[model samples]
Target: MGQALALREDFDGSDLRRLARGSRDADQTRRLLALAVIYAGGSRAEAARTGGVGRQIVRDWVMRFNAEGPEGLITRKAPGSPSKLNDVQRAALVQVVERGPNPKVDGVVRWRLLDLAAWVWDRFGISLSEATLSRELKALGFSKLSARPRHYAQDADAIDAFKKTSRPAWRMSARRSRPAPR
Candidate 1:
Protein backbone atom coordinates (compact mmCIF):
# COMPACT_ATOMS: atom_id res chain seq x y z
CA MET A 1 0.00 0.00 0.00
CA GLY A 2 1.16 3.58 -0.77
CA GLN A 3 2.39 5.55 2.30
CA ALA A 4 0.76 8.89 3.20
CA LEU A 5 2.33 11.96 1.53
CA ALA A 6 5.19 13.53 3.52
CA LEU A 7 4.12 16.86 4.97
CA ARG A 8 6.36 19.59 3.52
CA GLU A 9 7.88 21.82 6.20
CA ASP A 10 6.16 25.21 6.69
CA PHE A 11 8.41 26.63 3.94
CA ASP A 12 6.32 28.35 1.24
CA GLY A 13 7.96 27.83 -2.17
CA SER A 14 6.18 30.84 -3.76
CA ASP A 15 8.30 33.29 -1.77
CA LEU A 16 11.52 32.00 -3.40
CA ARG A 17 9.96 31.76 -6.87
CA ARG A 18 8.75 35.37 -6.65
CA LEU A 19 12.20 36.64 -5.68
CA ALA A 20 14.07 34.48 -8.23
CA ARG A 21 11.71 35.60 -11.01
CA GLY A 22 12.79 39.21 -10.58
CA SER A 23 16.58 38.56 -10.21
CA ARG A 24 19.01 40.04 -12.78
CA ASP A 25 21.32 37.05 -13.18
CA ALA A 26 21.85 35.97 -16.78
CA ASP A 27 18.58 34.48 -18.08
CA GLN A 28 20.04 30.98 -17.67
CA THR A 29 20.17 31.14 -13.86
CA ARG A 30 16.62 32.43 -13.75
CA ARG A 31 15.43 29.56 -15.91
CA LEU A 32 17.34 26.98 -13.88
CA LEU A 33 15.93 28.48 -10.73
CA ALA A 34 12.33 28.10 -11.96
CA LEU A 35 13.10 24.43 -12.47
CA ALA A 36 14.89 24.27 -9.11
CA VAL A 37 11.80 25.59 -7.35
CA ILE A 38 9.88 22.58 -8.59
CA TYR A 39 12.79 20.20 -7.95
CA ALA A 40 13.44 21.84 -4.59
CA GLY A 41 9.86 21.52 -3.30
CA GLY A 42 7.37 24.01 -4.75
CA SER A 43 6.15 21.56 -7.38
CA ARG A 44 8.05 18.27 -6.99
CA ALA A 45 11.01 18.78 -4.61
CA GLU A 46 13.22 16.83 -7.04
CA ALA A 47 15.57 19.68 -8.03
CA ALA A 48 17.02 19.93 -4.54
CA ARG A 49 17.57 16.17 -4.44
CA THR A 50 19.39 16.02 -7.81
CA GLY A 51 21.03 19.49 -8.11
CA GLY A 52 22.92 18.99 -4.80
CA VAL A 53 21.64 22.44 -3.83
CA GLY A 54 19.99 22.54 -0.44
CA ARG A 55 16.23 23.09 -0.46
CA GLN A 56 17.08 26.19 1.61
CA ILE A 57 18.95 27.53 -1.49
CA VAL A 58 15.57 28.82 -2.63
CA ARG A 59 15.26 30.74 0.65
CA ASP A 60 18.82 31.99 0.19
CA TRP A 61 17.96 33.33 -3.23
CA VAL A 62 14.88 35.07 -1.82
CA MET A 63 16.87 36.51 1.10
CA ARG A 64 19.71 37.62 -1.17
CA PHE A 65 17.19 39.27 -3.48
CA ASN A 66 15.68 41.08 -0.51
CA ALA A 67 19.05 42.24 0.89
CA GLU A 68 21.07 43.14 -2.25
CA GLY A 69 18.39 42.96 -4.98
CA PRO A 70 18.64 41.03 -8.29
CA GLU A 71 22.29 41.41 -9.44
CA GLY A 72 23.49 39.77 -6.21
CA LEU A 73 22.77 36.38 -7.84
CA ILE A 74 25.81 36.50 -10.12
CA THR A 75 29.36 35.86 -8.82
CA ARG A 76 32.27 38.20 -9.53
CA LYS A 77 35.75 39.32 -8.46
CA ALA A 78 38.29 37.66 -10.78
CA PRO A 79 41.97 38.60 -10.50
CA GLY A 80 43.30 41.51 -12.57
CA SER A 81 46.29 43.52 -13.84
CA PRO A 82 49.52 41.69 -14.74
CA SER A 83 53.04 43.19 -15.06
CA LYS A 84 53.67 46.10 -17.46
CA LEU A 85 56.92 44.74 -18.90
CA ASN A 86 56.65 42.29 -21.79
CA ASP A 87 58.92 39.28 -22.29
CA VAL A 88 61.52 40.97 -24.54
CA GLN A 89 61.73 44.12 -22.44
CA ARG A 90 62.09 42.04 -19.29
CA ALA A 91 64.80 39.90 -20.91
CA ALA A 92 66.75 42.96 -22.11
CA LEU A 93 66.53 44.52 -18.67
CA VAL A 94 67.84 41.35 -17.05
CA GLN A 95 70.66 40.98 -19.61
CA VAL A 96 71.71 44.61 -19.20
CA VAL A 97 71.75 44.48 -15.41
CA GLU A 98 73.26 41.02 -14.98
CA ARG A 99 75.68 40.85 -17.93
CA GLY A 100 75.83 44.06 -19.96
CA PRO A 101 77.52 47.39 -19.00
CA ASN A 102 80.89 45.68 -19.51
CA PRO A 103 84.06 47.23 -18.04
CA LYS A 104 84.62 49.04 -21.34
CA VAL A 105 81.35 50.95 -20.86
CA ASP A 106 80.96 51.39 -17.10
CA GLY A 107 84.73 51.55 -16.44
CA VAL A 108 84.25 48.83 -13.84
CA VAL A 109 83.28 45.13 -13.64
CA ARG A 110 79.98 45.02 -11.76
CA TRP A 111 76.62 46.65 -12.36
CA ARG A 112 75.04 49.11 -9.91
CA LEU A 113 71.29 49.33 -9.24
CA LEU A 114 71.21 53.07 -9.84
CA ASP A 115 73.20 52.68 -13.06
CA LEU A 116 70.99 49.82 -14.21
CA ALA A 117 67.88 51.87 -13.51
CA ALA A 118 69.27 54.72 -15.58
CA TRP A 119 70.15 52.34 -18.39
CA VAL A 120 66.66 50.83 -18.32
CA TRP A 121 65.07 54.28 -18.41
CA ASP A 122 67.21 55.24 -21.38
CA ARG A 123 66.59 51.99 -23.28
CA PHE A 124 62.94 51.37 -22.43
CA GLY A 125 61.95 54.97 -21.67
CA ILE A 126 60.34 53.62 -18.50
CA SER A 127 61.88 54.93 -15.32
CA LEU A 128 62.35 52.09 -12.86
CA SER A 129 62.99 52.78 -9.22
CA GLU A 130 66.24 51.34 -7.80
CA ALA A 131 64.51 48.76 -5.58
CA THR A 132 62.07 47.92 -8.33
CA LEU A 133 64.86 47.52 -10.87
CA SER A 134 66.69 45.18 -8.53
CA ARG A 135 63.57 43.13 -7.89
CA GLU A 136 62.71 43.07 -11.61
CA LEU A 137 66.17 41.86 -12.64
CA LYS A 138 65.90 39.08 -10.09
CA ALA A 139 62.43 38.21 -11.37
CA LEU A 140 63.78 38.06 -14.93
CA GLY A 141 66.16 35.24 -13.98
CA PHE A 142 69.40 37.11 -13.11
CA SER A 143 71.37 37.29 -9.90
CA LYS A 144 74.07 39.58 -8.52
CA LEU A 145 77.75 38.58 -8.23
CA SER A 146 79.93 40.59 -5.82
CA ALA A 147 82.62 42.86 -7.31
CA ARG A 148 86.41 42.30 -7.03
CA PRO A 149 89.30 44.49 -8.19
CA ARG A 150 91.44 43.63 -11.23
CA HIS A 151 94.70 45.20 -12.46
CA TYR A 152 95.79 44.69 -16.08
CA ALA A 153 98.37 46.21 -18.45
CA GLN A 154 97.01 48.52 -21.17
CA ASP A 155 99.66 47.33 -23.68
CA ALA A 156 98.51 44.31 -25.69
CA ASP A 157 102.00 42.77 -25.64
CA ALA A 158 102.29 43.33 -21.89
CA ILE A 159 98.87 41.72 -21.39
CA ASP A 160 99.96 38.76 -23.53
CA ALA A 161 103.20 38.40 -21.55
CA PHE A 162 101.26 38.69 -18.29
CA LYS A 163 98.79 36.06 -19.47
CA LYS A 164 101.49 33.63 -20.54
CA THR A 165 103.90 33.90 -17.58
CA SER A 166 102.60 36.07 -14.72
CA ARG A 167 99.11 34.60 -14.49
CA PRO A 168 99.95 30.90 -14.94
CA ALA A 169 96.43 29.97 -13.83
CA TRP A 170 94.94 31.76 -16.92
CA ARG A 171 96.64 29.96 -19.80
CA MET A 172 95.36 31.29 -23.20
CA SER A 173 96.23 28.01 -24.97
CA ALA A 174 93.76 26.18 -22.75
CA ARG A 175 90.96 28.47 -24.03
CA ARG A 176 91.88 27.81 -27.72
CA SER A 177 89.91 24.92 -29.18
CA ARG A 178 92.73 23.69 -31.46
CA PRO A 179 95.53 25.07 -33.69
CA ALA A 180 94.22 26.19 -37.14
CA PRO A 181 95.16 23.90 -40.07
CA ARG A 182 98.46 24.96 -41.66
Candidate 2:
Protein backbone atom coordinates (compact mmCIF):
# COMPACT_ATOMS: atom_id res chain seq x y z
CA MET A 1 0.00 0.00 0.00
CA GLY A 2 0.98 3.66 -0.42
CA GLN A 3 2.02 6.00 2.45
CA ALA A 4 -0.67 6.74 5.10
CA LEU A 5 -2.25 10.21 5.22
CA ALA A 6 -1.06 12.57 7.97
CA LEU A 7 -3.38 13.65 10.80
CA ARG A 8 -3.78 17.34 11.63
CA GLU A 9 -0.86 18.79 13.70
CA ASP A 10 -3.14 20.87 15.95
CA PHE A 11 -4.82 17.80 17.55
CA ASP A 12 -3.18 14.77 19.16
CA GLY A 13 -4.49 11.44 20.54
CA SER A 14 -5.56 12.92 23.94
CA ASP A 15 -7.40 15.83 22.21
CA LEU A 16 -9.31 13.39 19.98
CA ARG A 17 -10.28 11.23 22.96
CA ARG A 18 -11.45 14.35 24.83
CA LEU A 19 -13.49 15.40 21.79
CA ALA A 20 -14.95 11.89 21.56
CA ARG A 21 -15.94 12.10 25.25
CA GLY A 22 -17.74 15.43 24.64
CA SER A 23 -19.41 14.47 21.34
CA ARG A 24 -23.22 13.99 21.37
CA ASP A 25 -23.23 12.15 18.02
CA ALA A 26 -22.44 8.41 18.36
CA ASP A 27 -20.97 8.17 14.85
CA GLN A 28 -18.75 11.18 15.46
CA THR A 29 -17.59 9.69 18.77
CA ARG A 30 -16.76 6.35 17.09
CA ARG A 31 -14.85 8.12 14.29
CA LEU A 32 -12.95 10.27 16.79
CA LEU A 33 -11.99 7.20 18.86
CA ALA A 34 -10.69 5.43 15.72
CA LEU A 35 -8.69 8.52 14.70
CA ALA A 36 -7.37 8.74 18.26
CA VAL A 37 -6.05 5.19 17.85
CA ILE A 38 -4.12 6.28 14.75
CA TYR A 39 -2.84 9.35 16.68
CA ALA A 40 -1.61 6.97 19.47
CA GLY A 41 0.67 5.21 16.88
CA GLY A 42 -1.84 2.50 15.89
CA SER A 43 -1.86 1.26 12.25
CA ARG A 44 -4.63 2.04 9.71
CA ALA A 45 -5.79 -1.58 9.87
CA GLU A 46 -6.08 -1.35 13.70
CA ALA A 47 -7.96 1.96 13.41
CA ALA A 48 -10.31 0.39 10.87
CA ARG A 49 -10.91 -2.54 13.25
CA THR A 50 -11.60 -0.09 16.08
CA GLY A 51 -14.09 1.82 13.85
CA GLY A 52 -15.68 -1.44 12.55
CA VAL A 53 -15.06 -0.12 9.01
CA GLY A 54 -12.60 -0.98 6.23
CA ARG A 55 -9.17 0.68 5.88
CA GLN A 56 -10.46 2.81 2.94
CA ILE A 57 -13.15 4.37 5.16
CA VAL A 58 -10.55 4.94 7.88
CA ARG A 59 -8.45 6.82 5.30
CA ASP A 60 -11.46 8.89 4.27
CA TRP A 61 -12.10 9.69 7.94
CA VAL A 62 -8.48 10.78 8.31
CA MET A 63 -8.84 13.10 5.30
CA ARG A 64 -12.09 14.56 6.63
CA PHE A 65 -10.63 14.99 10.13
CA ASN A 66 -7.52 16.66 8.71
CA ALA A 67 -9.66 19.07 6.67
CA GLU A 68 -12.53 19.96 9.03
CA GLY A 69 -11.49 18.60 12.47
CA PRO A 70 -13.99 16.71 14.64
CA GLU A 71 -17.13 18.43 13.31
CA GLY A 72 -16.69 16.84 9.83
CA LEU A 73 -17.38 13.38 11.26
CA ILE A 74 -20.97 14.29 12.26
CA THR A 75 -23.63 12.79 9.99
CA ARG A 76 -25.82 15.18 7.98
CA LYS A 77 -29.43 14.77 6.90
CA ALA A 78 -29.75 13.86 3.22
CA PRO A 79 -31.65 16.29 1.01
CA GLY A 80 -34.50 14.36 -0.58
CA SER A 81 -36.22 15.02 -3.94
CA PRO A 82 -36.43 18.58 -5.30
CA SER A 83 -39.74 20.42 -5.10
CA LYS A 84 -41.87 20.12 -8.27
CA LEU A 85 -43.09 23.72 -7.91
CA ASN A 86 -40.81 26.74 -8.05
CA ASP A 87 -41.43 29.94 -6.03
CA VAL A 88 -43.58 31.53 -8.69
CA GLN A 89 -45.63 28.37 -9.14
CA ARG A 90 -45.93 27.95 -5.34
CA ALA A 91 -47.05 31.59 -4.95
CA ALA A 92 -49.60 31.11 -7.71
CA LEU A 93 -50.88 27.96 -5.99
CA VAL A 94 -51.20 29.85 -2.67
CA GLN A 95 -53.10 32.64 -4.39
CA VAL A 96 -55.37 30.18 -6.19
CA VAL A 97 -56.17 28.38 -2.90
CA GLU A 98 -56.80 31.67 -1.05
CA ARG A 99 -59.04 32.96 -3.88
CA GLY A 100 -61.06 29.71 -3.85
CA PRO A 101 -62.10 27.66 -6.86
CA ASN A 102 -64.70 28.95 -9.34
CA PRO A 103 -67.63 26.61 -10.03
CA LYS A 104 -68.21 27.88 -13.60
CA VAL A 105 -64.59 27.91 -14.79
CA ASP A 106 -62.91 25.20 -12.67
CA GLY A 107 -66.09 23.03 -12.54
CA VAL A 108 -65.73 22.68 -8.76
CA VAL A 109 -66.98 24.87 -5.92
CA ARG A 110 -64.35 23.59 -3.47
CA TRP A 111 -60.79 22.47 -4.16
CA ARG A 112 -59.88 18.87 -3.37
CA LEU A 113 -56.28 17.57 -3.22
CA LEU A 114 -56.80 15.62 -6.45
CA ASP A 115 -58.36 18.68 -8.14
CA LEU A 116 -55.39 20.84 -7.07
CA ALA A 117 -52.95 18.16 -8.33
CA ALA A 118 -54.76 18.15 -11.71
CA TRP A 119 -54.73 21.92 -11.81
CA VAL A 120 -50.96 21.87 -11.12
CA TRP A 121 -50.52 19.37 -13.95
CA ASP A 122 -52.69 21.44 -16.34
CA ARG A 123 -51.09 24.81 -15.51
CA PHE A 124 -47.43 23.87 -14.93
CA GLY A 125 -47.41 20.51 -16.82
CA ILE A 126 -45.97 18.83 -13.75
CA SER A 127 -47.59 15.65 -12.49
CA LEU A 128 -47.97 15.52 -8.68
CA SER A 129 -49.83 12.94 -6.61
CA GLU A 130 -52.53 14.09 -4.20
CA ALA A 131 -50.45 13.04 -1.19
CA THR A 132 -47.35 14.80 -2.54
CA LEU A 133 -49.37 17.93 -3.35
CA SER A 134 -50.91 17.83 0.13
CA ARG A 135 -47.41 17.67 1.69
CA GLU A 136 -46.28 20.59 -0.50
CA LEU A 137 -49.35 22.60 0.46
CA LYS A 138 -48.71 21.83 4.15
CA ALA A 139 -45.09 22.95 3.78
CA LEU A 140 -46.39 26.20 2.25
CA GLY A 141 -48.47 26.80 5.45
CA PHE A 142 -51.82 25.84 3.95
CA SER A 143 -54.27 23.54 5.77
CA LYS A 144 -57.28 21.59 4.51
CA LEU A 145 -60.57 23.20 5.59
CA SER A 146 -64.04 22.14 4.50
CA ALA A 147 -67.32 23.88 5.27
CA ARG A 148 -70.19 21.87 6.78
CA PRO A 149 -72.63 20.68 4.13
CA ARG A 150 -75.82 22.73 3.78
CA HIS A 151 -78.79 22.14 1.44
CA TYR A 152 -79.05 24.75 -1.33
CA ALA A 153 -82.83 25.14 -0.77
CA GLN A 154 -82.65 25.32 3.09
CA ASP A 155 -84.54 28.36 4.51
CA ALA A 156 -82.56 30.18 7.26
CA ASP A 157 -85.55 32.37 8.23
CA ALA A 158 -87.88 29.33 8.72
CA ILE A 159 -85.21 27.56 10.78
CA ASP A 160 -84.80 30.62 13.01
CA ALA A 161 -88.61 30.90 13.37
CA PHE A 162 -88.86 27.23 14.40
CA LYS A 163 -86.07 27.64 16.98
CA LYS A 164 -87.83 30.70 18.45
CA THR A 165 -91.15 28.79 18.74
CA SER A 166 -89.69 25.45 19.97
CA ARG A 167 -87.75 26.63 23.06
CA PRO A 168 -90.82 27.76 25.16
CA ALA A 169 -92.63 24.45 24.34
CA TRP A 170 -89.54 22.45 25.31
CA ARG A 171 -89.20 24.39 28.62
CA MET A 172 -92.95 23.92 29.37
CA SER A 173 -92.75 20.14 28.74
CA ALA A 174 -89.64 19.87 30.87
CA ARG A 175 -91.30 21.79 33.71
CA ARG A 176 -94.44 19.49 33.52
CA SER A 177 -92.35 16.27 33.51
CA ARG A 178 -90.22 17.23 36.57
CA PRO A 179 -91.52 16.32 40.08
CA ALA A 180 -92.14 19.14 42.59
CA PRO A 181 -89.33 19.66 45.16
CA ARG A 182 -90.30 18.22 48.57
Candidate 3:
Protein backbone atom coordinates (compact mmCIF):
# COMPACT_ATOMS: atom_id res chain seq x y z
CA MET A 1 0.00 0.00 0.00
CA GLY A 2 1.07 3.65 -0.65
CA GLN A 3 2.09 5.99 2.19
CA ALA A 4 -0.88 6.96 4.37
CA LEU A 5 -2.22 10.55 3.90
CA ALA A 6 -1.34 12.98 6.73
CA LEU A 7 -1.19 16.62 7.68
CA ARG A 8 1.60 18.66 9.21
CA GLU A 9 2.67 17.58 12.71
CA ASP A 10 2.17 21.12 14.06
CA PHE A 11 -1.59 21.20 13.25
CA ASP A 12 -4.04 18.98 15.13
CA GLY A 13 -7.55 17.79 14.12
CA SER A 14 -9.27 20.39 16.33
CA ASP A 15 -7.09 23.19 14.93
CA LEU A 16 -7.95 22.19 11.35
CA ARG A 17 -11.68 21.98 12.17
CA ARG A 18 -11.56 25.41 13.86
CA LEU A 19 -9.82 26.89 10.80
CA ALA A 20 -12.36 25.23 8.50
CA ARG A 21 -15.29 26.56 10.57
CA GLY A 22 -13.87 30.10 10.79
CA SER A 23 -12.93 30.41 7.11
CA ARG A 24 -15.23 32.62 5.02
CA ASP A 25 -14.01 31.24 1.69
CA ALA A 26 -15.99 28.15 0.71
CA ASP A 27 -13.11 26.55 -1.18
CA GLN A 28 -10.68 27.17 1.63
CA THR A 29 -13.16 25.82 4.19
CA ARG A 30 -13.57 22.69 2.08
CA ARG A 31 -9.82 22.15 1.86
CA LEU A 32 -9.48 22.62 5.61
CA LEU A 33 -12.32 20.20 6.28
CA ALA A 34 -10.62 17.52 4.16
CA LEU A 35 -7.35 18.12 5.95
CA ALA A 36 -9.17 17.73 9.27
CA VAL A 37 -10.62 14.39 8.19
CA ILE A 38 -7.19 13.15 7.11
CA TYR A 39 -5.71 14.34 10.41
CA ALA A 40 -8.42 12.41 12.25
CA GLY A 41 -7.10 9.08 10.79
CA GLY A 42 -9.85 8.84 8.13
CA SER A 43 -8.99 7.30 4.75
CA ARG A 44 -7.83 9.69 1.98
CA ALA A 45 -10.80 8.60 -0.20
CA GLU A 46 -13.21 9.44 2.61
CA ALA A 47 -11.63 12.89 3.02
CA ALA A 48 -11.81 13.49 -0.73
CA ARG A 49 -15.51 12.57 -0.76
CA THR A 50 -16.22 14.90 2.17
CA GLY A 51 -14.36 17.72 0.40
CA GLY A 52 -16.35 17.08 -2.80
CA VAL A 53 -13.23 16.65 -4.93
CA GLY A 54 -11.06 13.90 -6.37
CA ARG A 55 -8.50 12.04 -4.27
CA GLN A 56 -5.63 13.68 -6.19
CA ILE A 57 -7.07 17.12 -5.56
CA VAL A 58 -7.33 16.41 -1.82
CA ARG A 59 -3.75 15.20 -1.86
CA ASP A 60 -2.62 18.41 -3.54
CA TRP A 61 -4.58 20.46 -1.03
CA VAL A 62 -2.98 18.63 1.89
CA MET A 63 0.47 19.26 0.44
CA ARG A 64 -0.32 22.95 -0.05
CA PHE A 65 -1.84 23.34 3.43
CA ASN A 66 1.13 21.63 5.05
CA ALA A 67 3.67 23.73 3.14
CA GLU A 68 2.08 27.21 3.46
CA GLY A 69 -0.57 26.88 6.17
CA PRO A 70 -4.14 28.26 5.72
CA GLU A 71 -3.30 30.80 3.03
CA GLY A 72 -2.16 28.09 0.62
CA LEU A 73 -5.63 26.47 0.56
CA ILE A 74 -7.33 29.71 -0.63
CA THR A 75 -8.04 30.16 -4.31
CA ARG A 76 -5.81 32.51 -6.30
CA LYS A 77 -6.79 34.73 -9.18
CA ALA A 78 -5.84 33.45 -12.62
CA PRO A 79 -3.41 35.86 -14.24
CA GLY A 80 -5.01 37.46 -17.28
CA SER A 81 -3.68 39.51 -20.15
CA PRO A 82 -3.22 43.24 -19.42
CA SER A 83 -5.74 45.63 -20.97
CA LYS A 84 -4.63 47.48 -24.12
CA LEU A 85 -5.60 50.83 -22.57
CA ASN A 86 -4.40 52.07 -19.21
CA ASP A 87 -6.52 54.02 -16.68
CA VAL A 88 -5.56 57.44 -18.07
CA GLN A 89 -6.23 56.26 -21.62
CA ARG A 90 -9.61 54.83 -20.57
CA ALA A 91 -10.52 58.14 -18.89
CA ALA A 92 -9.47 60.11 -21.99
CA LEU A 93 -11.53 57.75 -24.15
CA VAL A 94 -14.56 58.35 -21.92
CA GLN A 95 -14.09 62.10 -22.23
CA VAL A 96 -13.83 61.83 -26.02
CA VAL A 97 -17.10 59.88 -26.11
CA GLU A 98 -18.91 62.42 -23.87
CA ARG A 99 -17.84 65.33 -26.10
CA GLY A 100 -19.71 64.39 -29.24
CA PRO A 101 -17.65 63.95 -32.37
CA ASN A 102 -17.61 66.95 -34.73
CA PRO A 103 -19.48 66.14 -37.96
CA LYS A 104 -17.51 68.42 -40.30
CA VAL A 105 -14.05 67.46 -39.03
CA ASP A 106 -14.76 63.74 -38.37
CA GLY A 107 -16.82 63.37 -41.61
CA VAL A 108 -19.50 61.44 -39.75
CA VAL A 109 -22.94 62.59 -38.58
CA ARG A 110 -23.20 60.00 -35.78
CA TRP A 111 -20.89 57.57 -34.05
CA ARG A 112 -20.64 54.00 -35.37
CA LEU A 113 -18.43 51.09 -34.26
CA LEU A 114 -16.40 51.28 -37.50
CA ASP A 115 -15.89 55.03 -37.15
CA LEU A 116 -14.89 54.73 -33.48
CA ALA A 117 -12.44 51.96 -34.32
CA ALA A 118 -10.81 54.12 -37.00
CA TRP A 119 -10.70 57.10 -34.63
CA VAL A 120 -9.08 55.02 -31.86
CA TRP A 121 -6.45 53.72 -34.30
CA ASP A 122 -5.69 57.24 -35.54
CA ARG A 123 -5.54 58.90 -32.10
CA PHE A 124 -4.00 56.18 -29.89
CA GLY A 125 -2.18 54.10 -32.54
CA ILE A 126 -4.00 51.05 -31.17
CA SER A 127 -5.97 49.12 -33.75
CA LEU A 128 -9.10 47.44 -32.39
CA SER A 129 -11.89 45.44 -34.05
CA GLU A 130 -15.41 46.91 -34.37
CA ALA A 131 -16.77 44.46 -31.76
CA THR A 132 -13.90 45.19 -29.34
CA LEU A 133 -14.37 48.94 -29.72
CA SER A 134 -18.11 48.50 -29.16
CA ARG A 135 -17.55 46.60 -25.91
CA GLU A 136 -15.04 49.18 -24.68
CA LEU A 137 -17.41 52.03 -25.57
CA LYS A 138 -20.23 50.28 -23.66
CA ALA A 139 -17.92 49.81 -20.66
CA LEU A 140 -17.19 53.58 -20.82
CA GLY A 141 -20.95 54.25 -20.46
CA PHE A 142 -21.64 54.89 -24.15
CA SER A 143 -24.46 53.16 -26.04
CA LYS A 144 -25.33 52.74 -29.69
CA LEU A 145 -27.89 55.39 -30.66
CA SER A 146 -29.10 56.61 -34.06
CA ALA A 147 -31.08 59.81 -34.62
CA ARG A 148 -34.43 59.57 -36.48
CA PRO A 149 -34.36 60.77 -40.10
CA ARG A 150 -36.37 63.91 -40.91
CA HIS A 151 -36.26 66.59 -43.64
CA TYR A 152 -34.49 69.81 -42.64
CA ALA A 153 -37.34 71.92 -44.14
CA GLN A 154 -40.15 69.98 -42.34
CA ASP A 155 -42.55 72.24 -40.42
CA ALA A 156 -43.62 71.24 -36.86
CA ASP A 157 -46.75 73.45 -37.06
CA ALA A 158 -48.02 71.66 -40.21
CA ILE A 159 -47.46 68.28 -38.54
CA ASP A 160 -49.44 69.35 -35.44
CA ALA A 161 -52.34 70.70 -37.62
CA PHE A 162 -52.43 67.49 -39.67
CA LYS A 163 -52.58 65.34 -36.54
CA LYS A 164 -55.40 67.47 -35.08
CA THR A 165 -57.58 67.35 -38.25
CA SER A 166 -56.91 63.83 -39.58
CA ARG A 167 -59.21 60.87 -38.86
CA PRO A 168 -57.89 57.28 -38.85
CA ALA A 169 -58.97 55.00 -41.74
CA TRP A 170 -60.11 52.38 -39.24
CA ARG A 171 -62.57 54.87 -37.66
CA MET A 172 -64.44 55.65 -40.98
CA SER A 173 -68.17 54.60 -41.02
CA ALA A 174 -69.27 52.01 -43.67
CA ARG A 175 -71.70 53.56 -46.19
CA ARG A 176 -74.06 51.33 -48.34
CA SER A 177 -75.20 52.65 -51.77
CA ARG A 178 -78.25 50.28 -51.83
CA PRO A 179 -81.14 50.41 -49.30
CA ALA A 180 -81.37 47.53 -46.73
CA PRO A 181 -83.69 44.63 -47.67
CA ARG A 182 -86.92 44.33 -45.65
For each candidate in turn, the TM-score is 0.37, 0.78, 0.56
166 Cα displacement, candidate 1 (Å):
27
Model 3 deviation from the true structure expressed as Cα RMSD, one decimal place:
8.3
Error of 2 at 34 (Å): 0.9
| Top-lDDT candidate index | 2
The candidate that achieves the highest TM-score relative to the unseen native structure: 2
Model 3 TM-score is 0.56
Question: Can you write out model 1's per-residue Cα lDDT over 1-182, one digit (the tens) per residue?
Answer: 53323323433456446656666655425634544455354543455443356656644554454455445556557676566578899877766665656788776556788877777677888877877877777776667777555566457577677674444565556546887779
Q: Put down candidate 2 lDDT per residue, 111-182, tens digits, no spaces.
A: 999899989999999999998999999999988888998999999998887774434444345676889999
Candidates ranked by TM-score, best first?
2, 3, 1
Candidate 1, poorest ten consecutive residues by summed lDDT:
2-11
Residue 113 lDDT in model 3? 79
lDDT of each: 0.59, 0.92, 0.83
| Model 3 Cα lDDT, one tens digit per residue, 48-107 | 999998998988998888789999999999887666877887887787677768999998
The total of clashing pairs for model 2 equals: 0
Which candidate order results from sorting by lDDT in descending order? 2, 3, 1
